[model samples]
Target: MKKNYGYARVSSKEQNLDRQIEALTNYGINERDIITDKQSGKDFNRTGYVTLKNQLLRSGDTLVIKELDRLGRNMDMIKKEWQELQENRINIIVLDTPLLNTEGKSDLEKKLISNIVFELLSYMAEKERIKIKERQAEGIKKAKEKGKHLGRPKAKYPKLWEMYYFQWKSGQITAKECMEQLDLKRTTFYKLAKDYESKLIK
Candidate 1:
């Protein structure tokens, strides 16, 4: 009475889930037993994945995915979840990695091999993630050194800022009045005033 369940995932809406779905279906999994999520693999909090794990899947059921990373991106969390599934007696098959498959094998040697392969792959995945982050940090630092803006560009100073700033500073106009005249928020007005004053001092 073991059922075959397939899971498919795409990190963003722009990416198509068709490839994963096709692979699952071609593997002979029933359409009803295939669940998909259009969300990041960073976590297992996705609705489709959660529903499969909590409600649909049961002991002795086989869970198949196109790849290990489809389950999650975090190596530690992936290992924890894999252990949990193993403890629950649920089988897993990664289509891209035959060595990691836990299906149709009851032999101790096979199990040991699978464990070794899983550990090595998980470690490599985590290391790759760390390298990517380091590369990103380095790129951002270089961009900053080149005088490129990182985040959103600073808002441009409104026209008539000099007139409004002088009036506000001399108490000829209230802060709210200056903001209203310039159609700017109080914070923006104050920030522009400070920048203007700094320019004058320089």
Candidate 2:
């Protein structure tokens, strides 16, 4: 027989899962068949989600969530996981988004519905990311206008860095010579060189 499983998530341990669990149960999912995770929606590393996806769910199993965010808040990651689950032939149903439910849908219907939802979701998520970046930039501008120091202080260059840096860049001196002069390891010398070169390019 095909099985149905419920996955519920709360962003933090202090938050209640009562609401999500209640909805899942009312949808006729067995209490024992529901897995709950008390963790951030930032990633899919939660114990419950991992176990539910890897261990419990099987081909033809239907996974239900109260909301799409319960799958994850990061849309990019959510879309990846969604694709994986579909590939594995597991059905998905979001209680709040009935259009995504695939339990009894034909294969063609499932593909069409998921594709449309994914595209719409990606568009919205990209817009949200842009808005967030714009808000952050505005905040930074205000802070700069107020003359507040932001970000880390620039890392000071080591002694005798300038002369050796030029020599290394011009290939007049080997990298080993530059590292030995600056008392830097090969990795550190190359990283500093890259950072310096990037600044020069800018």
Candidate 3:
């Protein structure tokens, strides 16, 4: 008996995989037959996905995915994996776009349509990724031009820092105690305090 397997992936743990799993279940696939990866699609080194590839797949089994790009970030790798699954007699059904399924259609028209959709979606995904990177770069450039710090916001310690400095100088409070009272983390407190000391000496 052939089994239907579903694959769902998200780039990070913060992303919810429930919707994808729900869709698969609604499509009649069993929860036991679904394999999920909570890792980046940028690479094929995902733990759950690797296990599914090595052990779960068999000839005549159908593999389901929400989208083609969910399989991998690299276009060439995505194409290769799609071909590999097909060559193994495992059909692919993209839930969002059923026309990409290779189980039934084989005519010239069908093939042509499939190719067009694949190329279009693949190009769109890659373009969107690039656009996000460009936007981030532009945002950073604008922030720098406006004299904004690029990383974490600087700590504001108006009275507490002054008190810390005074107590530390008088030997009444240790540096650790000053840090504890300031409620700033060790690294941040040390960095700010060190910079202040350096400037005072100069």
Q: Judged by lDDT against the true structure, how good is candidate 3?
A: 0.80
**Regions of model 1 farther than 4 Å from truth:** 40-44, 107-114, 133-202
Q: What are the C-alpha RMSDs, in order, of all predicted structures? A: 5.5, 7.6, 8.5
- Each prediction's TM-score against the native? 0.62, 0.67, 0.59
Residues 96-174, candidate 1, lDDT per residue (tens digit)? Answer: 8887888877857446855885777668888899999999999999998999999878778888988888888899999
Q: What shift in Å separates residue 82 of candidate 1 from its native position after superposition?
A: 0.8
Candidate 1 C-alpha error for residue 10, in Å? 1.4
lDDT of 1 at 90: 81
Model 1 lDDT at residue 85 = 78
Q: Where is model 3 poorest over a 10-residue stretch in terms of lDDT?
A: 105-114
Say which candidate scores most in lDDT.
Answer: 2
> Scored by CA lDDT, what does every candidate get?
0.83, 0.88, 0.80
Q: How are the candidates ranked when ordered by lDDT, highest leading?
A: 2, 1, 3
Which candidate's TM-score is highest? Answer: 2
Model 2 residue 195 lDDT?
89
RMSD (CA, Å), candidate 2 to true, equals 7.6
Output the worst ten-in-a-row residue range by lDDT, candidate 1: 105-114
- For candidate 3, the per-residue lDDT at 141 reads 95
